[model samples]
Target: MADLLVRGGTVVDGTGAPPTPADVRIRGGVIVEVGPGLAPAGGAERVVEAGGAYVAPGFIEAHTHVDGAMWWNPDLDPLPAYGTTTVVFGNCGMSVAPLRESARGPVLDLFCFLEDLPLSAFQDKVPWTWERWPEYRRAVEGQAVSVNVAGFVGHLTLRTTVMGAEASWGRAATGEEIAEMAALLDESLTHGAIGLSTNVFDKDRYLKPVPTRLAEDAEFEALADVLARHPGATLQLITRFNEPDNIDADVERFARICKPRGIRAQWTAIPSTVREDYLREQTIALHRRLRADGVDFWPNVPHKPLEPFFNFERALTFQRVAAWNHWINGPAETKLATLADPQWRARAREDWDNRVSSSTSRLDRPESLILAISETGHGPLGISLKEYADREGLHISDALATWIGHNGILSCLRGIPDAFDEPVVAGLFAEPHTLTNINDSGAHLQLFCGSGENVYLLTRYVRDTGLLSVEQAVHNLTGKLAGFFGLGDRGVIAPGLAGDLVVFALDEIEVRPEEKRYDNPDGSWRFTRGPAGVRATIVRGVPTVLDAEPTGERPGTMVGLVSPPN
Candidate 1:
């Protein structure tokens, strides 16, 4: 690798300190110097002139699901352009390792269903050459990727591997099963896994709770005990954020399991939305109480609002609604037949009226649903579903069925997102124990574009609304996440640190509009956004993205937790 010099930029060292004018020099994928008036070494050197730009440590994607996607799409498109140099995957109990041949299909099925990922792509694209964590790590490290990758050992993967896939979902593990799971977790942590991630928040297309939900208190205790033995290992849980009533009990249970074991526990989030202020207050109070008691539990928060696109081809968004879930999980012929079936339509209306939660699915609110995409160009696009129903003199559910039937099933209905709450976001941004930037990028590819969502933190919060200063925003994106994940080597712009950095003028970057891309292995399409106009996104001294385009360079390596809090 050639030596590199980044010049003429205001350096924000990612320590929440004020920005200062400086130049950074790198050699052998490590920062060698940080000062102004730095000249290139006598050897070969590449220079990036970052005039009038902010130079900061490369942004870390704190939460993502690129574990399976990385196998086929190694470039991790648009992430490089958004200044993301590191990505953390294996989240929400969806890692793709430690599986037996019998568990492979079940593991992939659960991952695809819950994540809204294409099942065909996962079945065909990923090279499942390993059945253990160490082998999985070697397979990933051998691949050339655009960003550094770290991951956790998924609880679902572990359960399915030890206790047959069918039994894993049916009942709580036996004592022997729990012991086997603990042994596997210990082996994974000893190998390189950052920690363990489990889910209590999801149901599959069949409305069945995930296998992790079957885990008992003894199971959790066993896993926590294993994590306690490993220094710098953490425990991650995805709780029921949608069901606000159960959140307090979930937090208390998790604290009991991991807090006593002396392991840091990171949960999916603390609700922060304009529509859910009451629930947000409850969660905030819960977190405060945990802090007062000195519990090492950190809650994550998403900086972007929830904007989802619903489609029938393959989606879990309607799993909460019985009528829709049944129709969506059926075969193609069954789907078309049931959409026109009068009995089915009646049941759908009943489900819409009584079963669906307004906070989750927007099926009840046709007015806020836009007919965004048309797979067959059957006409009538870009109109709200309510308008279509009004013009056609049809019920809302009937109108939706007619639209999807007329246009191809691949057509999508886009929901208007909740309003972004500036004050709530600002408070969480400044909160010491809160983990920001929980963008589920890599998963839900067709549902929403998570690629450029991180740009909103810099664009909306810092530049537009002034909710956060640039220093604070950068620190939250870089240093804070690195520390939480125990990645001691990178996430800062200083000598001896890994050469991971981004450069761009704040005014030049904005979250780009989402567009469709037909790049899936099965010739299917997915939603993806374009660049955020970042001048450069360098990973380990190599410029993966330069001048807003990919450089076709793959310098990423398999990174692991270096110093996780005990």
Candidate 2:
């Protein structure tokens, strides 16, 4: 007898297949069968009223920061609302595993640099039980999350274990240390870590020439060998270049590192930025080279709109803050004092007006500057430094300075000079070989307009801009992501997938920009958003979010590297 049944769902199987009207049956967490309709089999007791929902496979967020969120909040919101049943945590070479009481690792600093959330508030809420990867996995086993999650053994985490935080930055691991690291990685993989992750960028710090930078070509190759040991495993990396020729070399090196080990290595993003022509040609070349080397290498192109939010805690966007740390990462009074100091203010004005402008030519080009989330929610987002200054009736230069002083840490992304070609970015996501996912959901809690990535993505690109087909957009978010990570069973809706899904009212999904809310840490403002059209969301046959708020039914799992029984 089935444990539960869902009747009258429009199933858009994540296989890029068209929707089909059917009733899905579930038993013991797995979809037992699906067809037009059927009478109760024996004693199927419960039934879900899926009158108008489109039941597809739960979303697979390949890149996420829920490793910390889960430790802090069990019923993670926003994530479940996207129908994300399984999220791939420990992305970007950072992990909460292999942590030891004595292991002071550079990744720890990296993690601190990443999130400024006051998760310590929940210290009395959850027990800090596990010290290893497997134990942590077990600890989360029965927790009721709106979705399932898979853990990965991060590369920086590997380094952190072998060499404590201080040593990891400058010194390369000795041969014995490397072997020890390898053993630890193998153990983690066996314990259910899905794959490996490493990043080339540290949104905050300027990485110097260090061991992570100078890892012997052989070290990464060895890591790839470890990945090869798991045939279905995947790799997520953020490289330095997407230029055609340079990207080719990068892909070549990565593929060569993975081919012998039979691992698939994918880059974090191939966004439509200033380097579009180079990125497209280079991407095509990368696929070609991977084919030749028999290496599974593909870049996960983000078709989503992006806006990284922040306040002074995570990434303090004001330049020269490094030279003035006490003014930023320090006490509030000190920060306010620094802002009020005439000497520093005069110096900053001097630096921006004279030195900063020297780099920009007189030519009228699309100026690059980080946009601020002034209006509070996602609606008044992307308001540029230029716009903000104009709105306040001041010169752009004066406004920029005052903005930095007044806003402190609550600014979004700083614009780096790059050419823009929206069409190229659209084409990239539109390609079948390329997929889109903005893996920033759990990370930028306060700084940017990044939390509601899916909202901006669906509304902006697909609906407003007409960049992609709704089917293609949904496919990228659902099927493409699952396949990349080797979670075959839950990617598509069929007779045997989990009944994880979402149903939005389409036109109602717009999000209005609002200021930081219920500031977690003494009102430490980062960024907050609310979407318009999300009607209902479900996870593993449970309604985790109804009308866009968390329902506290955590039906998630600590997913393993290998696929589960069909």
Candidate 3:
């Protein structure tokens, strides 16, 4: 007597195998059987006719900033609907655990700044009842969510819990402080953290470096030693490889810490642009070297374009320039004053010019910056800055500034950079060591939407371009990533595995246009989209999404590494 039976679907079993017509039987939240004509045994409590669809392992979102979003929106909408069954949170050195009473305000503020999360969302929605890592895990587990969650103990949280505001202000921890942090990390892993996550590149909202950025080499080695003690514990790093010469050095540092310890290290945002071909090649070569030396170093790369839509009010575009930090972090009056100042304008122009020539700029040409939305007709509503500037006989920067001054906070710009070269991106996907991820789903809520990237890869890359076969893409999203993260019981359509599955029509798949929704706490607006072609997403043998809609059933639970069977 199976709890559920999915029949007549082509099963892509998440092992890079060719699809085969099969019937899957689920009982007691795990797959009981997968073969032809299994439903003939005749006692399925519920049967889903998945004819003309592909039944595959549900997606595992490898990187997300949904640490706080889970507290506010337990359903974690748009994710489950897009076929994500599990998500790894607390990325880029941000998490909501291991808090001290004194460090509460600073940690929340840092989270709000680094992830672009609204402070009101946390203050109004979260209860802030827990402090230690175990308590925090229990609190989140108590919540009702539609997708499974596996979180890393954040390095910033550990540092702040041990050293308080001194760590928040970029002060390097003392030797004793490092020992305390390491001990806490060990305890966190023992309690149930998936791994340890740290960021060496990100800065807080106030333009100050994150706590992990201030850590010395010895501190990182100490933390790695703690990770080494716990088998299957991973080290997630946001490497400071933005500069050319530093790439090899950063990789070597991570490899040194992870190699001898037999720990896996995963780094973020390997570039997919033509301009960064050199960086990408160097990264691949370095990964090969590390792998040959018996180090497991995986570089996470994006399957979609690294573009974000933003408004002048909260423009992450300008945040890259140090001169624009005050404007972004300050109040309206301060931003207005800065915009009005000639000295500030000159400095901003210089900074923008310098960034444009650097490897970090998202925009290749000013004309590619499209005005996505606007309330004022100061400039052309949907035209590029170059067109508006040429029409008004002004510099592009001046034209943008004038429009923002009149439109105020209501204008939005779509910063779609021409950096993502299709051939280079496909090549990266085909690479053996690269992990297809980097969807900053819960973060950048107002700026852009990356939640549908998993489906986007399937529709655009596999179905349309034929760059990657369905088998390879499914493996990339499921079994490969699940194995990397040690979620052993999921990410495969096999007997005794957790029955997290998705059934979707291959020909009809599509990612809808981005829409603005006022769904967050305090009536703040965030960009979202509806998904198509996905018929149903089942978590733990229960359908969380049916026919592209939430079924209001939360069968998801906290998942971690499974102990080896004796």
lDDT of 3 by residue, 259-325 (tens): 8888887885577777678777887777778778888888887777655676655544565666776
Off by over 4 Å in 1: 356-358, 376-383, 387-393, 564-566
What's the TM-score of each model vs. the native? 0.96, 0.82, 0.94
lDDT of 2 by residue, 1-566 (tens): 12666667677667677777887776777677888885556564466555665656666776777776675556565566555667878776777776664552345555655554443432334455765777867877856566788877777777767777667766777777777777777777888887888765444344243235546676676677777787577787766553333555655667667777678767744545554555556665666566665666777655543433435543434333333433455565565466667686666555555432211221112134555444234323466666666688864545654665655545443443354465666666665566566556666566444445555556766778787655556677788777778776677666666666666544666655635556443444434555444545656666666665666677777767546455
Candidate lDDT scores, in order, read 0.86, 0.61, 0.79
Candidate 2's displacement at residue 195, Å, is 0.4
Q: Candidate 1, residue 189: CA error in Å?
A: 1.2
RMSD of 1: 1.9
Off by over 4 Å in 3: 40-44, 353-357, 363-365, 390-396, 417-419, 563-566
Query: Would you give me the overall lDDT of model 2?
Result: 0.61
Ranking by TM-score: 1, 3, 2
Best by TM-score: 1
